[model samples]
Target: MMVTNLCTSPSSTITLRADEWVNITTIPNKPGTKYWVSAYVNVTGGTISLSMYGDISASQHVSYQITAVNAGAMSMTYSVVSGSPTVTVTSMLICTFAEYQANKTLLDSIEYFDGDTMPRA
Candidate 1:
């Protein structure tokens, strides 16, 4: 497994206005693998506008969301969060998974590097 740094906002900072949706960045989705998205938001629990396309968004706010696409890219957006009208994201992670059984010896290194988290996308 490997965790990859896909994209970040300019200077790793973004401030979203009330009810505003800002395009954070885009990520590529390779075939035959899953992506684990971890976003570091200023607020603990707030509505982070994350979805594939537009129809897949959830009703409530969530800090993280997973995307499973065949072969293409996804546009990420940040909208609103709870309690506060503005939200700032310091960083984000887009990790891809690689089977460890293929190489038993390398498992140790992967474990040390990511601790169960996938490495670079």
Candidate 2:
């Protein structure tokens, strides 16, 4: 399984810029598979918005694009403007069909067959 992770921390306030793009790539790169992508941010006294592309799945590998938006704090709500937004990806996983099939075959081979039924102990 291939995995990727991203994390971010912002002090006070920050705003995201257009040029700044958070990208996660080079997963398994398998077709018909699903991948899991997630984002996590640790910040205090600030509001943040997150956006990303691609669906979260565990059967395939995929890429994602994420963005973050920051809202100013109460003290600077009106006077202070949010700085560049920062985004952090928390976790990613690529589960390909080949891996799944291999696991299944291994499991099947491990089971003991008795007469007409197979028993797993």
Candidate 3:
């Protein structure tokens, strides 16, 4: 089994202002490929806006992106963390299209069953 490491920044912190989009980090991306990103940002307050592109409003935050369509940038942003202006990005993970598909295939092979009936021990 291939192991994927979680990207963590235990001691790192970033501040975001209310109603303003702030660039957080950028992930390496490949053109013509898709990516699955999971960002774990600790926040407490009014709201938090996150996106992969700049100029995104709070209502425009997105979790998935196609690299080619967005000019191959995997940047991240946070519009606000309100009551608490600072936040810690506990962990994050970015999975490429190929890696996602490979994992999907592996999982299916190991856990999927065709019949409706339960398999006997």
lDDT at 57 for candidate 2?
A: 18
lDDT of candidate model 1 versus the reference = 0.43
lDDT of 1 at 85: 37
lDDT (tens digit, per residue) of candidate 1 on 1-121: 4334554342366554544445444555666665544444454334444343222223322234454555555334544434433456544444443333334356434332212233333
lDDT of 2: 0.27
Q: Count the backbone clashes (under 3 Å) in each candidate.
A: 10, 10, 0
Per residue, candidate 2 scores C-alpha lDDT tens digits across 29-103 of 333333222222322233333333322212222233222223211110111124433333322322233433445
- What's the lDDT for residue 38 in model 1? 43
RMSD of each: 7.9, 16.6, 10.9
Off by over 4 Å in 2: 1-21, 43-48, 52-83, 90-121
Range of the 10 consecutive residues with the lowest summed lDDT in candidate 2:
71-80
lDDT of each: 0.43, 0.27, 0.42
User: What lDDT is reached at residue 100 by model 1?
Assistant: 31
Residue-level error in angstroms, candidate 2, position 63:
14
Residue pairs that clash (backbone atoms under 3 angstroms), model 3? none
